[model samples]
Target: MIYDQPKFLPGGDRYMLVEFGNEMNLELNFMGQSLAQAVADNDVKGVIETAPCFASTLIHYEPEDISFKDLQSEMASLIGTLGPSEDIELDSRLFYFPTVYCDPWTKEAVDDYRAKIAEKEPDPEFVARLNGLSDVDQFVRVHSGTEYWVASLGFWPGLPFMMALDPRCMLTAPKYNPPRTWTPQGTVGMGGASTCIYPVATPGGYQMFGRTPVPIWDTQKRFPQFENSICLFQPGDRVKFVPCELDVYELVEAQVADGSYQYNVVEYQKFSVRNYKAWVESLDTSARF
Candidate 1:
């Protein structure tokens, strides 16, 4: 689809950043992703790789094969033919993740850092209050109530930066000021305007709320679901967090241990930005909080 003129900025010597817009928006993300796909399909020489983010595409190219000026001209020409972002269609997948919200693990982690890391209350409760919800139960309900769009994956492999598909489900929270020294793998957290699952235990800034039993990244790739790659989630995929009791979480963990657990995945063709925008606009503001 046709997009506004992109700002092409040089990213050091080997990379170029094509920015569709300064802000984070699905339309802008679509443009970036579509352009990245177009580049791959065309197999343009010297283009080593392309990384699409919320509103920009980072291109890594061989400087010896094509000059910066030449590559820039080629990208500009290719972008000119790309229709509009809204009209672009994406092949997407829907996944179901059984989550235990306010589980003991993340709750303990939040408590451990309450004096130094948290702003007011525990992470989950603080987030609940921030969203104007009455309690943690409502927070869990609202969080799992809508499908989340996988905007991109970063911070760690298979760690998806997700945006709620339904505008009414949108909730915002700031990242930790000092950041946490450690976050458990499978931890579900939210920072800024996106949500993500920690693929591996590591330092993070997102406020932890819940935990999922399933593994999103497996180095061995031994399971049937992990046959394609180590990372389970991808951009354009939709994920629905299903709240589950501790007992259910343990069952899933047992299945995972035996390598018999199959991820719930539904395949579909193309997401329409036009239709999504219409739905977003139709939702009442009160439904958001």
Candidate 2:
């Protein structure tokens, strides 16, 4: 749920955390993103950077330039100037990723967890049952049916926390009780209602079901898309997971190895929240893919 007004709290001396709400919703994120964009556009004097999260925006500032109190005041004033969530327009890029669902890599990881940690159902099967899908195949169909919204990047560099843009495609699962020691890089999974692709091998708790060979993060700057930043995605980007077989995954993996992987992207599209809401209203919310 959205708060009556955003709450302003100081993060030590260098940062301020502005929260739109406690719940994870697109409306709340839009409010935070809109404010973040406003800060950037207006050239807020002391603000160094703004990181918008699922429900809040963390602002880094130079205390020497402006006091925390003054920064809060400035942010509050800027928030007043912004019209509504529907009025927000942001540049969004679409990326198509070839994903192999119910693949061996994540299966091996899940097997290892069951052997060492505790006995539990396999990740894909467990998630499918939990969501009342007929089977893992149906789960994959629903999961890959719609484009996902890139709400924020965090927990790891270039790691996106995304939500289904289509209501029928939403799937939720709980995280691992004793988190896995390591997760394969490019592994795609979900915790709660958010889906994430691990940028690199790291300890994770999301229920893993799919793996993508395409690199979302590259420090070596292998791809042309990584020219601006090491991370391939920005907040508000859209992602479509194209379900594929292991053969296709290996082919793309090989291309990435030699630095010839061409990114499938539609760039520089303006996303209008007003049009998005209208589209959502026209859908059958009770339907499933």
Candidate 3:
């Protein structure tokens, strides 16, 4: 797909922001990610690092080695050769996180919030109604049925903001009005138009729905999955939430406590945006839910 010219704005003396579009969509996100990869491939002088967001990329560079204008020109040149977002292929990994939906932990958290913060119905029921689903079970099915794309990692270390790969599975809900004071680590929540998995305990606004025993961030990097970094996710990776019973959740928690837990991951598949778009176009809206 053809996109409009990107807007390059001065973030500061050492940083620059390249915005592909103002809207949040896969096409813009893919372009941003593709540009980041292109910059890495070229290895342009003085360019320090690049952070790709939902629809923009932030580039850090040293002013001593290269002037801001020169670096901007270089980046524009690199972006020019990026061609089309749909043609970009990503080396993506697929991961499965065993989750217990509407579990005791999240239920308590939600109940606590409702008592202290807002007087409202249970979080699961609220989210389910907001998404046009009949009940919590149907909501869980819709959430876990489609693959979610890890658009970017932010808010806190290893926390991933995920977007549903299938449009039919996409659901939207408003964030908590005042935000939660503390969200349990491994809590799965949705805010605005995206879903996220909290890597650590932190304050948040996303509607909490489930809790996963699997660790998304390991500060010690004890497992093989976290060998490269403490963060277990990266842009372009895909995650599927597999609903589990309380017994299975406790079993995984025991394994995790003993450092014997192995993450279920598949690295065989490479994501192709062109093919993905085509597949999405072919699917009927009813099939998504």
TM-score of each: 0.89, 0.91, 0.89
lDDT against the true structure, per candidate, is 0.86, 0.92, 0.88
Candidate order by lDDT, highest to lowest? 2, 3, 1
Our model 1 lands, by Cα RMSD against the true structure, at: 2.6
lDDT by residue for model 1 (245-281), tens: 9999999999999988988888865677888888788
Q: Candidate 2 clashing pairs?
A: none
User: Which candidate achieves the best TM-score against the true structure?
Assistant: 2
How should the candidates be ordered by TM-score, best one leading? 2, 1, 3
Give the Å shift of residue 265 in candidate 3: 1.4
Candidate 2 C-alpha lDDT tens digits along 133-178: 9998899999999999999898999999999988889888999998
> Against the hidden true structure, what lDDT does model 3 obtain?
0.88
lDDT against true structure, model 2: 0.92
Give the clash total for candidate 1.
4
Q: Of models 1 and 2, which has the larger TM-score?
A: 2
